[model samples]
Target: MRIRPITRDEITELVDDLWLPFAGEMGDIDEYDALAEDVDVRAEALDYRRTQLDDDETQTFVAVSDDELVGYTTVAYSESPPVFARDSGAKVKDLYVAPEARGEGLGTSLLERAHEWGRDRGCARISLSVHARNDAARSCYESMGYETRYVKMDRPL
Candidate 1:
């Protein structure tokens, strides 16, 4: 598979293709529900990611197998945010792969490319947020050498 940056025209396709990784096999909610526990994300909430990709500070990446889009990701940066990342170090807002394509190291490959992108742009660090309930992802991040700098928590009555 070839990994490359995304074009604006692929926005909608990206949004739909994202479900493969984030939601699992779509026709049935059972599989999606099982994976959902590991990711702690909803399809509807993904709309925000789609919107962010179209904004000025955000960027999108895609993994293509043949002519098909197998996976995609989103990253962004704030010129004035309180974080300590490089002026070029983008905060990775999204990273996912097709369910059928998982376990094949595509996620690692995707991040490697994303890191290169950040470096090319002068980013010293690539940051991202994952849900607390997403244990598998948390493990993946940890294995990738990311450390917990802080946490955001909330409880609703």
Candidate 2:
């Protein structure tokens, strides 16, 4: 498998594969279904990713095997709040590997690339959010040395 930064012309292809991760999340969390119902997700995702193509602070990477697009990740540079000790950090906005590609380590490879990108930009840390109930993903992240730094809770009124 080869991993590289995606070009503008390939944004459509990347967007096409986005549903794999989205569907997975929807299946793993009930809240995502409500979230999806509230927006035109496909169009919104396409528009957002398109904007990242020309933004220096953001990056999108794709993994291909046998000339077929299989997985992707998007990461961006972020500034910490004034109360935080760190001035800047890297946030992994999204990371998804196709179901058929899960056991391969594509996720780890993609995350390593994100780490390299953040390090190059002089980021003090890297962070990402994961659904509380997604055990598979949480385990994968934990194995990669990611720790839970905060929790967000909600109750319906």
* Candidate achieving the largest TM-score: 2
Residue 74, candidate 2: Cα error in Å is 0.8
TM-score of each: 0.72, 0.89
Worst 10 residues of 1 by lDDT: 25-34
Expressed as tens digits, the lDDT of each residue in 84-124 for candidate 1 is: 44354677767888877888888888887877777777767
In model 2, the runs with Cα more than 4 Å from the true position are 20-24, 33-39
Highest lDDT: give the candidate number.
2
Each prediction's whole-model lDDT (CA)? 0.71, 0.84
Misplaced by over 4 Å in model 1 are 19-56, 80-88
> Candidate 2, after superposition: displacement of residue 118 in Å?
0.4
Model 2: residue 139 alpha-carbon error in angstroms: 0.7
